[model samples]
Target: MKAEHQNLYQPHKGGTLCKMLFPVLLLTLFFPLGHAQSSMSPEFSIIKPRHSRLLKSALQRETSAFLLSDPWAPLENQGWRSCVESRNGPALPEKSEGYIQVFLDGGLNQQRMGICDAVAVAKILNATLVIPYLEVNPVWKDSSSFEDIYDVDHFIDVLKDDVSIVKELPEEYSWSTREYYATAIRDNRIKVAPVHASANWYLENVLPVLRSYGVAAISPFSHRLSFDNLPMDIQRLRCKVNFQALTFVPHIRTLGDALISRLRYPQDPLKVTAAGDKEMAGKFVVLHLRFDKDMAAHSACDFGGGKAEKLALAKYRQVIWQGRVLNSQFTDEELRSLGRCPMTPEEVGLLLAALGFDNSTRLYLASHKVYGGEARISTLRELFPLMEDKKNLASSEERSQIKGKASLLAAVDYYVGMHSDIFISASPGNMHNAMVGHRTYLNLKTIKPSMALMGQLFLNKNISWSDFQQSVVEGHQNRQGQIRLRKPKQSIYTYPAPDCMCQA
Candidate 1:
């Protein structure tokens, strides 16, 4: 067996298993028992988490048999098709109003969300958006401009009806830039927002000021525009900006698209016909493996690692994550129970195995180099021997195109994941959120593990592979492609689901 990943298991995540024992349906239709795991397969012996009340009703949640009703369910009232068709609105006048200047920078996900907010704000304020400035992180200080990574002309053309966009300020303002400019808030050199500003907030608070001053210079300029009770038009416009307007630079897009085609239609007929390899023919899963040093530390999951690994990750966290370790109120144990940590690669391997994916199942891992390198991924490699990443899959010439280009490389990951048949995220980070919204926007399925159930089932030493597969398939039948709804309304800004996502 692989090194024990005991740390990945929390202190019984689900509430107390209901005292009244109930029998579960033993058979699963989709995955037959005869086709299940061989008895010779790896058997993991785990020290089961002591049952806590949080994981109650585990044995009897589903009282009766149920079949999958719809493979693709939708969010009601999002009306994306209607909204995109009805996008004609009064934009800012050509010669009259001031400008809404936004600076977009960060890793790919942050910048992607920023672009949406900037476009939505421009629509709200009825001000022309000066070509939003794009900044690269100093970590990977590639001197790539916005146009270098994205098709600037395509952006302007796609959003022509939504708002007037310009690469730079007009000649008049270029000469007297400081004189014509006004910042988002009263402070000349500062930006202010007490909360994730609402579209109405922009319309009411910022628009009048833009009209008065003819230019609003917003710094850190884009993020967290609201989605809740705001006008439907604003929500729809956000979707358009995210899915339609922003596109990768031509060459990078071409590479990603070519990769997509290959995955969708592998040339080898044997790959299509082979028992385990049939899953590779099209729609391979993209595992956004987030086991990087920074992510693990921020999650406070002190999973197996030596003192050097711990210290290295801790120190790295202090430098990158807001210049300090995230001082969460919860303890590491508590965090694990809450599913706050990324699943260990071993845990993920077991998960896919339980889901019936085998060694030959094609899995494109969209990630940075796995932390702890090959040793850490050893267990996962045993389960998924054919897993591929950019390093393994790309040709030397293709690798050169994305080498040293972090943003463009991230774009490639995004496109590949976006087109995959299933996208399984290690954690719900920016990559997951961004891709989930886009995939949801396109009415596609994304399989998110129900950790609550997994935490319970994995504990039972007597649980067979067939029973586990039955539980997972039945549990998640409707979960895939389900219209995501915001639970607590405040989370919409960060999550932007159902709001940023719409059913056509």
Candidate 2:
């Protein structure tokens, strides 16, 4: 598994300048209008003729700022809404002989986010209508603007059968997965392409489609795209579009709250819990260790070749496990799995005394080969007499997978969550756990620019896992030392039934 970096901000030199200026402009324009509204609801007075003109200018500026700030906000006071409502549905330009439409399949990620990115390019370039998946049903229903929307019911057939808009796609774009998504873009006469096409391949094959649709430039953030490889002609087209006259001067609206608002689902119960758990809700640091068994995708960067890959995985696993043991307060259940064997009985006795366990921290055994089929349970029972109880031995074996990969990972996560007091994760494979959860410590080896941006965004959310750990280590150290396991908030699971107590 490759290291994953989180990408929060789309890369744009111009966009960065726009972000810095927008807030100041909004603040300057908003204050007076808000004061006037509070002072007089329906009407207000301007002391002088010059003041009246200045007031009108302020109001116009305010309206523009509000529209940009919140596209979803009501635009009744904003003259732009009325302007749009009044304009007759403009006919498609003669040059717009074809179209390039996109439909997102799943939740926001590289794919949907990339498409959203195209919004800026399309607006600036006067490209053919590039509607986002969310905007299919326009919020304001005006006929002229609404005519651009085509019903997607027969979208697949249209892509496969339509000849007017599409041309043959590249061979690599003909894979089954590509065709599956291409169903939406294909025209009867032309073959629509997939997002997976390399930047160069897309520019070569899709430029004609853009020109046919009168689309000079497009935003394509939803895919792994780069302008570095575009053909010289396509670059010239973009330059031309940048200089072309605009029917409407482009305006970008930025809302800091928009992303958070989108995260709230309509069906969400919106539950909030009291701060502390019944028992010391032991901080379970999740360390995800992703070992890619498949050897197919390593042709490009084989510095040490296959030998390097194996070494990387082993080192990664060892580092994560050692970090967890050193940083966290672990129970006997966890220490037994650490594989740090004592050289002698005296050494083992000292280790047990240090742990405050009565010769019960099972001495790590060298002969044990749980990764292969060995009597790990029998070995454990012999080492720790407390496990002589048949029921106890059976339970231990059931909880710990001494052999298989899937089961081992599951057991590790479970044991940490159940018994540890702090957690740190190193895996980039399980995106939800690594990216979305309340993570406190992360052990990522690579620091891509996109990932750095994501880390900044992740910190904005107060409940992230890393934040939780920081609060505990800094503010709650005294509290943890005195902490005792409270009664389980819910019941623990038995052998035949799986545990539901840990469900998030």
User: Which candidate number maximizes lDDT?
Assistant: 1
lDDT of 1 by residue, 1-504 (tens): 012222223345562232111111111221135322111111211212232221122222221233233322333333443134334456545663567777665788887778777877887777888877666676567656678778889999988877888888876556323333332324322256434676777776677767766666666665557656766667767767777888888888778866766655656422333577655556477888877755666766565665555554554443334224554667655666566656767667666665556565678888875665666676676667767787876778988988988888888999888778778887777887787767766656677776656655655656655466577668776556565566645444333455554445
Model 1 reaches what TM-score against the true structure?
A: 0.73
Give the Å error, residue 200, model 2: 12
Q: Which ten residues in a row have the lowest lDDT in candidate 1?
A: 19-28
Candidate 2 per-residue C-alpha lDDT over 257-326 given as tens digits, one digit per residue, 9 for 90 to 100: 1111111211231322235522322111222212122111121112112343334323333322321223
Candidate 2's TM-score reads 0.23
- Cα RMSD to the true fold for all candidates: 14.2, 29.1
Q: For model 1, state the Cα shift of residue 377 in Å.
A: 1.9
Structural similarity to truth (TM-score) of each candidate: 0.73, 0.23
Count of steric clashes across candidates, in order: 10, 24
Pull out the clashing pairs in model 1: 14-54, 14-55, 15-53, 15-54, 15-55, 15-56, 16-53, 16-56, 18-57, 98-214
Q: What are the runs in model 2 whose C-alpha is more than 4 Å off?
A: 1-208, 211-223, 227-272, 275-282, 295-504
Q: CA lDDT of 303 in candidate 2?
A: 14
Model 1, CA-based lDDT: 0.62
